[model samples]
Target: MSDPFDLLVIGGGINGAGIARDAAGRGLRVLLCERGDLAEHTSSASTKLIHGGLRYLEQYEFRLVREALAERERLMRLAPHIVWPLRFVLPYDAGLRPAWMLRLGLFLYDHLTRLKTLPGSTSLRLDRDAAGAPLQKRLTRGFAYSDCWVEDSRLVVLNALDAAERGAQIRTRTTVESARRDEGAWTVTLYDSDKRRRESVRARVVVNAAGPWVGETLLRTLSVEARPKVRLVKGSHIVVRRLYEGDQAYILQQPDRRIVFAIPYERDFTLIGTTDVAHEGGPGPVVISAQETRYLCACINRSFERQIGPDDVVWSFSGLRPLYDDDAAANASAVTRDYVLELDTDGPPVLSVFGGKITTYRRLAEHALDRLGPHLPGLKPAWTGTAPLPGGDMDGADFERFLARLVAERPFLPAATARRLARAYGTRLEHLLGDARALSDLGETFGGDLSAREVDYLVRHEWARTPDDILWRRSKLGLRSGRADVARLGRALANPSADPGAQRP
Candidate 1:
């Protein structure tokens, strides 16, 4: 490109990727830069639910709830492969909120979404229903509700991929060292994280979708006068062996009126989590504290007959929520889950986003683009709702049905391996596998549905620049694969010239 034509986005999280995808689709030449792997920050570290947070109703946030509800359905329609319907069993506790109050909240949640394929919320009898099988024989009444689950990191990648396919430049391992606005455009110098090299670009408008780093990106890098305050609330999750026997997930009530989720994850593991506490430090490399692990373990042990100690915890991860600093005196859990867009329109326009979720990213992008309308008068009207994300073009967002078609054609492949491929790549599985015949044709197996061919495909198409990018983010094969297997893939990838796909120019 001659220069950064129209816009330069500073973050590769969901908000930044979504904004870049939207702007590029609207005929603006754009560039998106990420300091690390995409979604390595707060965007990937989410509760992974695409719902109109039922608890937000307690704060009287009807507008945010309604908008998120609408986006939930919209995302389900667009990316059914990665985003699917999940039922959460909320066991009732008489001491906490009364059954009637819980019923009222459930009633609003049911009606908030324009009920389509997702089932409405219903009251359940813990003794009578299968959802209550894993719980202790305490408390009789409960509520089972529906929400959507998403692959958070993949969502960011898909947006970035879509943006790239539309002629937008996407640079991973690239950090914005400094940005300044000249007469009508932004002058930005970026340092590559891997190569330790610097490159520069100039654009008419700049977007700071840096999530938790939004404040620092403005204050330290851009040297802006006013920085939008954002609260960094830490939330953590622990992966334990699957506790329940069924597909349903449990939403447990804590002593402090907070909630925890124990959902089925990657076949054999149960992903449980999320304690909201005030965090003062930076967002990078935030790990689950020992206290957080204990809090989560205690929360799980309180409700279920199957007690899970620290030993039961196989893996743990934590993320910081860059929430908009709404003046709330209560705890971090009580802080608002809403997002805000701060625009600097004085000289060259700069739009900074604070506090958003994976559920509402599309709408957030559309709204962000709308805020920039005054600057880019020739921008196209907002249209992400009607467009399908990359690899989500399958009919009706139906993965199973699409998998059946893939299997029919590739009958030689194992059913489990094929299903895994179908879920991860959707209709693109055929393109990834590409006329391969037997198990041996897939090259070497790295255990748990991972193969050499799949690794090659990811490095070629999905931006797998690192081992963690392949093992954890692109897929959860690392949870099952052994150390030796990971080392094998690492050694193979290190010899870039020997690899079939080594970032060909």
Candidate 2:
């Protein structure tokens, strides 16, 4: 048998990528395998907010709130290009939550974590602000607070990229067929979905962050009975034409007490969502149901000046949260977003992660490694907090300044193109753009602003192996790019020699 890896991470979502990145950075030999492309599941299908779950304050989850809030501050610095500060406008209605209670909650949110960069919350006169102009007349006043927005999928990719650069092996479109414990190590058999090849590797530890299939991975793949059950809660989101004109998002409180967000997306569309409902069936592609679309539209119509219906929904997505079954709350919305790490040290040590959100993923990874301390030899101390992610190591770590430099360096490129590349690739755009000074030098354009140069870069550096991987996950240009563009992009990817620089990692 070959030398065993120090750790093996299953799943490539934010949680798994964060763990692999953390472990690898500490100089541990790591290998992360995913059944599909990175963030092909719940990690990408998020409300894309990095903030303390303000509503969780009602649940009295003070610890979770504080931790998430702190992480929010850290991430804004860590990935400023992909993560930026945003203001959320919460319109007040005396019926849902009283003025006094809302004030107390916002006060707690502002003070729960030390604020160095983000602004604190304050009551606003909605009638005077543009935020109020888009709202219903009844909502005359509200509060505005700070949080961070993320390109959910890109966050996962950057983590995996940083991990790989730090000496971890990332294998996408690969599945662990079986994992059998032998002495102090695990013999894992992996199947490459695309190559139709099978191989086995040895690992001292297996970290299961398979998300919705955590139980299934333990039971079926590891041939062990699943422990610490998970409750699958399905969250759905809907997109529509821009509902209002503003960068500020809305946090509307429903009569049922659940909160929904309406945020700007893709510069031209409004993203609204999400409904919490218990999932009934087994593993499969989750989509927003007609009922969910209607519910979201109704929720938006309740707050926005321009009312919308289900028919107005342009796109929708859904993801299942593999929450650790606490059984403490009967309602899915009330279930804990905090994570639980269970380390089975009986024989071969296996760690399973249950119930976590994107905001707390970094902390989750740190805690996950801490659990394996006794099992790992010479494990390095935690260090991810102070380190910058891939393409995020900009001088001053300022996105706008770095963007100005990119456009300044490549004067031939369009301003919008440079901005998009900077947002998507950050410092790495230089590497992708190479010496190409003109649009013609960047190579053929495949619908929208996507170029062959960028496609080749994704294939070489990022694990973008298919058209869907390029059009949808790597970039959301698929929403605007036509079917013909997709077909052409597929053809472009197939002609490997076309670019000549597209080298697979």
* Top-scoring candidate (TM-score): 2
Which residue pairs overlap in candidate 2's backbone? none
C-alpha lDDT of candidate 1 relative to the true structure: 0.85
* Prediction 1 TM-score vs. true: 0.97
Q: Model 2, 234-333: lDDT tens per residue? A: 9999889888887999999999999999999988899897899999788657998888888998898788789998888878889999988987888999
Best by lDDT: 2
Identify the runs in model 1 with alpha carbons over 4 angstroms from their true place: 498-505
TM-score of 2: 0.98
Residue 492's lDDT within candidate 2 is 82
lDDT of each: 0.85, 0.89
Minimum summed lDDT over a 10-residue window in model 2 is located at 496-505
lDDT by residue (tens digit), candidate 1, 1-505: 3655688899998999999999999999998889988898787788888888888898898989999989888888888788889999999976898889889998998887674578888989999888888888996789999898888888888898888888788888899999887767788898987787997788888999998899999888887888468989999999998898998988888879898999999889899988898998876679998999999999998899899888888988889889999776468988888889999877888899999778888989999999998898699988788888876899877877888888898898788777777777776676678778877788887767688888888777776877789888888888988998888888877866544333321
